[model samples]
Target: MSPNPAPRPSASDTPPRRRSVQCAGPHGLHRMSYLEWGDADNPDVLVCVHGLTRNGRDFDELARAMAPHYRVVCPDVVGRGLSSWLPVKTDYQLPTYVADMITLIARLDVDSVHWVGTSMGGLIGMLIASIPDNPIRRLVLNDVGPVVTAASLARIGQYVGMAPVFPHFEAAEAYIRAVSAPFGHLSDAQWRQLTESSVKAVDGGWAMRYDPGIGEPFRQTPLLEDVSLWPIYDAIGCPTLLVRGAESDLLTRETADEMGRRGPRARLVEVPGVGHAPTLMDAGQIAPVRDFLLAAGAAGGGR
Candidate 1:
C-alpha cells in the first residue's frame, strides 16, 4: 500500500500577519489593523475582540487553538494596538465601533462568522448580531451583559484613559498587574504579554498603546443601570454563550441568569475563582468557548 499521505499542518503553527483595512467614521475614514491567522481562503471565520484598553494580542492563545478550524481574526479596535487613531477623539462610542466592525466583516468577504467579545467588545458584538441582515452566526459574550454595575463602572473609570508614563517596561507591567488584578488567575507570562501589547515606548519613556482620547466619549457618558440595552440584547437571534466570572463585578449572576431566560436564551458558564472576566489564555478557559462555537456550527441552526 502507498505510504500514508502527510498529515495536514495545523494553522496554529502559522504566525499572524498585521493587515490593515479602511473603515468609515463620522468625521471621515480611518484604518483598522488586525492580526490574521489560518488560511486566507478559509470561509469559516472567527473574530475575537478585546476589552476596553486591550489590543488584538489578547486572543493569542484562543486563536492558536482554534486556527485549525477557522480563519481567526483578532482586531486592534482602532485607536488601540497598530490601528490608526481617530482624528476626532470624542467619536469613540459603541455606534462607531459597530460601524468599524461592519467595514472589517466586508473586507473578510465571508458568508458568516463566529464572534468572541470581552467587556466593551461584547457590547459591540451584541449590537452587530442584533441587526436583521448581519452575518454573525454564533456569539460568545465574555463577562458582560445588558446591565453594568455602578461599582464596576466607577472602578473602571478610576484608571481608564489615564496613560501614566512609565520609566521602564517593568514599571508599566507592574501597573497593568495592579489595575488588572480583577482578571484573576493569570500566569506570569500571560501578564507579561498583556503588558507588552498594552504599551509602547514614547519619546520620553513609555505609555499605553491606546489613544487616551478614546476616554473622552466615555467620560461624557454615564454607565448607569437605567441605560438599558435590553432592547438591543433582545434583538439578537443568534445562538449565544454567556461566560461570566463567578466573582465578576461587571456581569452579575442575576443578569447572566436572566440572559438565559430571554432573547437568545444564551447558555451560561461561570468560571470559578475569577472576577470581571476570564483571560482564556489557558486550556481550561479555551475549551468551553471552542466547544460552544464549533458545536453550534455543527448543529446547523439547531438553536
Candidate 2:
C-alpha cells in the first residue's frame, strides 16, 4: 500500500519554540534542549528522536509536515545538538539517555505520547516501550532493531567523534555528505540544512557541535559479536511500526522479520537504496510515520 499523503503546515502556524529542561544525571544535572512545534495546548504529542550522531534538527521537514495534526517535539538527546555534555564521557550510555527522556516527558505534562525513533533513538524507545504500562501509545523504529551487528558498530566507531575542523563551510558540508552518504539521496538544500545544524564556528574554523568525548564509551567497549535485545523487543505490547532501509547494514531483513512476528507485531516498511537509517526529511518517509501515529485506535488519535 502507498503511504498516506502528509498535510503541509498552514501559513498561520507559528514556528517551533526552542526550550530546555534540567535533567538529573550520574553527576548533578545537565540541560536537555528540545524544539516544540504546533499548539502548546494540544494534548496529542509526537516525539521524534534522531540517530546516534545527529541532532533533533534532522527532523525539521518531518516535524513541519506533522505539526498540522499533532504537537511535534524534537529533542537534542543529551551530548548532541544544543544539549549540554555529560561531566563524565562514559555517562553517554542508554541509562542516562533514558532517564533524561523521563524528565522531558514529565515536563510535557502528558499521560501518553507517540514516538518516532531513528537508529540509537529506536533502541532507547524499545527499552522504554518494553516497560510495563509505558506511556508510549505507539512506536516507530526507523532502521534499527534489537540486534545490532558488531560490524556496523565498528563502522560507526571509525568517525563518531573524529570529525575535523574545516576552514570553510563548504568543507564541512562535504564532510557531512561523505560520512552520511548512507542517508541516501537528499536535496542540495537538505544537505546544507544538515551541515548548518551540525557545526559551529570555532577559533580556527568550524567544528562539530557535539562533544568529541561522547565517543569514549564506544571506544572503551569493543563489541565482539552482535548485541541482541530480543527480550526487550518481546516485552513491548503497544502498536508498533518498523521502517528499514533496504540496503541497511545495521538492522538486517532477518531481524526485522522477527520483530514483525513477535511483541506488538510491528508493521514493516523498507525504503530502497537507503542504508543504516532513513532521514525522515521527505514525504515518502514522513507519510508512514504519520499514518501509524494518526491511525484509528492509536493513542491520542483524533484529538
Note the Cα lDDT for every prediction shown: 0.86, 0.87
Q: Candidate 1, which segments miss by more than 4 Å at Cα?
A: 1-8, 223-226, 296-299
* lDDT tens per residue, model 2, 1-303: 011223345711778999999999998889999999887777777888888899999888888877876778899999999999988999999989888888898999988888899998999898998887678878999999999999899999999999999999999999999999999999999999999999999988999989998888989998989999999998888888999999999999999999889877889999999997899888999888878777766773221
Candidate 2: regions farther than 4 A off: 1-12, 300-303
Leading candidate by lDDT: 2
- Say which candidate scores most in TM-score: 2
TM-score of 2: 0.95
Candidate 2, poorest ten consecutive residues by summed lDDT: 1-10
- Give the TM-score (vs. native) of candidate 1: 0.94
> Against the hidden reference, what TM-scores do the models get?
0.94, 0.95
Worst 10 residues of 1 by lDDT: 1-10
